[model samples]
Target: MRVKPLYFFTILLLFSSLNNAYAFCGFYVAKASSDLFNQSSQVVMVRDGSRNIVTMSSDFKGNVNEFAMVMPVPTVLKREQIHVTDNKIIEHLDSYSAPRLVEYFDENPCSPPVMYKMMPMAAPAMKSDSATVKKRARSLGVTIEAQYTVGEYDIMLLSAQQSGGLLTWLTEQGYKLPQGADAVVGSYLKQKMKFFVAKVNLKKFNQSGYTRLRPIQIAYDYSRFMLPIRLGTVNSQGQQELFIYALSRQGRIETTNYRTVKLPSEIEIPSYIKTQNKFADFYRDMFRTQVKKQNNKAVFLEYAWDMNWCDPCAADPLSNKELRELGVFWVNEASNKPQISQRRRPPQQGQNVYLSRLHVRYDRHNFPEDLLFQNTANRENFQGRYIIRHAWKGTEQCNAANQYFKSLTKRQNQRAKNLSNLTGWNINDIQKTMQIPQRSASSSNEDMWWKDLWSQ
Candidate 1:
């Protein structure tokens, strides 16, 4: 109660400095604040540029005290998925194909059960913002082993008997394969399987027409990962040889590309590219090649916002010029341009005269001026069919569409004559077959399940 003013003031100053200390008393920065390191459990704490201000008592030390490094281990450094640019992602993605199918191998002549599965029905296609995921196939199950991109080189083994019998299985499952298609599928499978068995027996068949490959297991091999690795086939000699791709040190199941061309099975790939650099340059060149404007090729471009403000809607037109350019004629509209209509004027009261002297005149006006018509001459139509996308107000529009398609078969016949050799096919049938289903004109939206049945 009787303390001096100076003594009290000094004590207050000391307490204030203690409470306002910058951080923990010691200057050594913390290595880690918690147990989680590379695992999904992420740790984020305050750091002053150089180090974290993490504090721990002596009791908090154990296996849970795993220190997190700034960067990941060298092995897992490769990003699990690839990084693509904005423009390249959208443009190039559409052009990619699943490299090939998966392969199945056997040991002791089918003693080991051969797991043969296909991915045609694995899952709905992948949907992404930058690109459309056409998932030629999908991994049915997940394990510690992750899946790889479809187009890589890999091998498989199957019982010759099983592969041969699969033709019958395709029929029982209600797949309607054309005679020519069945022949191609069968022959391809048989040849591959035959080479496999031939190598196992070490029987040297005619190596003249045959590309001689000394049978040896590839040291670097990739995993199947549930992809539809090209199902290989056996030959008449009951033998098969498969080319396997080992996963890279970076964990990617990669294949030397077409330019760098590697085949999982004994496929007679025609040589086009000469060197590995040529192979690496192949895709980049391809990306450049596609951007080049080809007068012959016409694509069905779907713009997101222009068609309708709806999310991810395809732009369909009463008449799309691109389709017409490809010789796909859209039934012409009634008139290319709209015209002003003439109307009758109101009759004047108590005005009577001879027929020639009548005061009635036609009241007509030109079409309304709008931005749509602002661009060009009135004789021609608008540059685009600008409207709310999919604006089918009534069944009348749908009925018109139905009627147009009803005669589409007949048009393809006449068009087949005029279609010329532009598409490289003699007729639309081949192109129809070539189309990657669901994108075809004849592809039905009403019942795709039935169409899927027919497609098989």
Candidate 2:
């Protein structure tokens, strides 16, 4: 474990406004993956009433022996309440919930237009410690409630009477905490929260033969539905990126403290974004623009839909078995909810698992409080989907074709403007890349009648 206050152990999108009337087919092309952000963490939270399961994964690129995490929890988790989960499941969920780029090809106007649509493809326990450790902990007003070596981690549940004592104890035990964490830890201590600390057991880690650390999951029945992110933000160099995948049996999850704003979605952008790394670049810059637009105080909702199916899926939905592993204990529960619509398939009943993806970019100055979440009754489906329309490339010479080409000019120019507005990219630059001339203030639809006469 890299002892520099395990930031890795911490559990922790803009919309475009070009609303075209064309039918949207979720055609998954590319996505802004979580790895794009260097200082980022991913957390999967499954909530049903007071029962909450939180799985935290970190991208810690450090020595395994130097890794450890100190988390604040409402209750002392037993050995059975903690376990290690496969990282792939979280990756799958990340890809599934990530903001994606979808494309639509324009139908040839000379021929009949068919509705082009694409369908989305779909723990152990531990024992007590030695007497010397107990005596030292008691002297520091800290109680070692429980200890267990679950999987490759040596876990400890602690209740501290004061932050000073806890900090000293942690220092003595080699769990290096970041500076300025004293106050935050003190606040949680005052709230009657218990500290769940874990460090890798080198023997077990070596025996397991895994190159990277698996995510640590904790399950407990508590009334508080909040995640302690303040601790993770302490001693930060700059704003940190956090992707929260919240799953609930009731409905979507929203932050109670901060504004939970849905990112601009289902909008159209320039077709050139489909080439090379433009989509990824477009997403990253667009997200940065939204962060600035919201002043970095808003939590962005990237995706919220029934997990039963996804149209233009970035990845297949997690199986019930995977859901169960991620702490959706009620995945097997029967429900009367109608199945979400899918292409060429009958609507079957759903698993009632509504997953919400929330992206937050924050720092100590902006986000002073840990994220508090609530499950709402709203089940409206939404996604951060950007569309790129490929104009008709045929050279047929009909009146319908002429009208289509005329409409294409306006569409292409509007898309350029949309891209500029969303990402703050220069309109002239976008048009240049699209190989179209910049639309001037005096430009009109009638003036562009012959723009696309022979080519796209």
Candidate 3:
């Protein structure tokens, strides 16, 4: 069977900035996206056993007619296996998984500790004249396995005996194959991989009345759980940012070929981040700093949680229907129905789904191979959670209040230091930005204690 190549779509570096909201736990500030870095791409992969569904969203800003994508497939996909889904699903997934900033306020130390519990949430139709093209392809050692029109895309499944023939054919088809792509194509050919090629059907796209191209979804069964990203790196872009959202039935998914490190989370950050839309910038800078600290050789786990519940939800979890729409085939609606009982219970929070979000800033040097993934039994929940503790500003005359006041300076200084360490920002600049008094360069412990006591 002929397969499509995985290089048809041009990677667009787009980022998303969400509006901030106040949740019961804290304020849900900005969330991070690929836009923080240039040349970013997002992929949502849903896997169960040997079956897999992959949805790819592109930020292509070029003309629709020039839009094309090539994907490597384990098997030739039938027309029914390919689909075009709404972009919102992927956006929702991004928002749900993106690193988030949550803000909290400290209660007055003088006040009684009231224990208040707060809970917070495709294929195109083949033409008869294509028979001549088949004969021509055979002469060139290429096979067109399948062809069909699905939604707004015309897709083809192709298999090649050699890289040269495939490259020649792709070039003739107006694909503008990247330089040095032949070697990579040959490697896939050696592995017996098939290529899936797709191009936008202009007539269909125009008639569909869609302003933007929807994400492309493909379903197949392949035991090798890996994503082919080598072709994307062939471009001269310095570094590409990729966000992979993996959903599995077992538990959290992680990269096996590369180190999968969790991003720093639940740490208190400076409160200035919440004053404006600086949360996204802070996240972006912190991520870059972390990546640099890792020497750009690791994949960062931004979020990994059971779909059932979130401590401080960035966005609501995907519903069963939405999960199914995203190619999560294992979610059975019947099994998810509420149980009728004498006492009505709150609806279920999460189903059997588990999501893992992996962020990587890769280049040809650091990530020389495509990503290989494994679903682990580890179900421990993790999120790129940053905290902002707003200091109590009320004046209450008490011994506790005096101690709280005395520690305020220390806390602010620590916050400044944390922000500096996280984002690689200058300590002086951070203190200036926070409008906190700068500490004397030569101040000693004795001087500081006296300053703290007398200043207050």
Candidate 4:
């Protein structure tokens, strides 16, 4: 039997906007670079069995007329299978799974240990178009299989027999095919992948009266669970940052072709970082450090948790309606609630929703192939949680208080070292910045003076 070509579409838009996007499991600070080449691209992939739904949000910042996208899909999508969704849903998902910082205060060590039982914490949360005269497309060996105007996007399903022909046809039609894209396009063509191309319909966009472009959602069924990032890397500037939010019925989703490493998390850092509003910088630097440690060849898992609950939620868990809107087909409207047994009560509203946040900084040299993924049975919860422990500030003269003060100095020094190791910041500079007093060598000797005197 002949295999059918997977229809993929590319949006020809410069993804360069800064709208408080989320990266993997953390919010991409608005202050980060918003340039298309510098900013991050966000993708939400929902997989159940062989069905896959993808929602892509671009940060395109240029003339709307120049905006276009080309995506490779596994199968041709019908009008019903394609929809334009509000950007807020993507933002909500980002916020729900984002890496979070939780603050804890240390109680007075001198106080009697209150046998207070700890209560459990509650948990929280593409298109294209076509056109053309028959002669040019035919000469280029590009065929327009279908066309539709979905929402503000003019979409087209195209099949090209040759990459050179497709390139010529795209250029002839005024689509700016990036240099060095021909090889990537040729590779996809050899695999019989179809292209879905889309551009913003100015009239529709103006009529819709939306200031920014919304995300595009597409649904299809194919055995391959992968994302094509090679196109985005072609003729690109430095490394490109991509955030993938993978939702699946199974546990966490990870990259199959590359090593999927979890980001450093649940570490106690200096409390001053919170007051200094340096969490964003800290995360950025720490992420860079991890990428460097991995030799820039691994995908970092920022967060992996079930959708039912969160320890300290970054944002409220997405409702069933929101998940459905985001193209989670398995969510049943009537039975959206979790299954309850006579022995146990359900924890949250939704059931069997697992989200994996994968962040990757990629370049052509490091990521030569598209990303392949596999859903695993490992359901262990993980989050990029940074803790801030406020030191006790009591002046009590009890024996416990005295020991606490002595240990406090050691703890603070360790915190400084942790910060320096995670961010590659100078240890002395970090100490200076945090106003931490440097420990003197003489003070260390003073603590062991008896031992030193005996040895002499």
lDDT of 3: 0.70
| Backbone steric clashes in candidate 1, count | 39
Error of 2 at 10 (Å): 4.2
lDDT digits (tens) for residues 1-456 of candidate 1: 221111000000000111111111100012222221111110011112111111111111222112111110001111221111122211111111111112222222212244432211111011111112112111211111111221111111222223234434323322222223234334434433211100111122232232222111111011111111111111111111111111111121211211111112212111121211122232222222322223212111111011101111111111222111211122232322211212112224211110000000000111111001000111111110111111112233455556554444433333333222322334445334323142434554433447656655
TM-scores for every predicted model: 0.15, 0.84, 0.84, 0.85
RMSD of each: 35.9, 9.8, 10.1, 8.3
lDDT of 4 by residue, 1-456 (tens): 222111122422111123211111111111112233336668888888767678887665555665676776655568887889998887777766766677777778888542222112212220002234556687778888778999899887778899999878766665656667798778877877777787789999999998887788887666667777777777665687778889888899988899999998878788777778777778888888999999999999988988766666676666677788877777765534423221122374547889898889888899887787788998999988877788778777899887777777667777888988988988888777766656641264445568666655
Higher-lDDT candidate among 1 and 2? 2
Model 4 compared with the native: what TM-score? 0.85
Q: Rank the candidates by TM-score, best first.
A: 4, 2, 3, 1
Q: For model 2, which pairs clash? A: 1-64, 1-65, 1-66, 1-67, 2-66, 2-67, 15-264, 26-312, 120-312
* Span of ten consecutive residues with least summed lDDT in model 3: 22-31
* Cα displacement (Å) at residue 430, model 1: 37
lDDT per model vs. reference: 0.18, 0.72, 0.70, 0.70
Error of 2 at 12 (Å): 11
For every model shown, the clashing-pair count is: 39, 9, 29, 37
Report lDDT (Cα) of residue 126, candidate 1.
Answer: 17
Ranking by lDDT: 2, 3, 4, 1
List ranges where model 4 is wrong by over 4 Å. 1-38, 112-132, 334-350, 440-452
Any runs in candidate 1 off by more than 4 Å, and if so which? 1-165, 178-181, 187-247, 250-257, 260-456
Displacement of the residue 384 alpha carbon in candidate 1, Å: 34
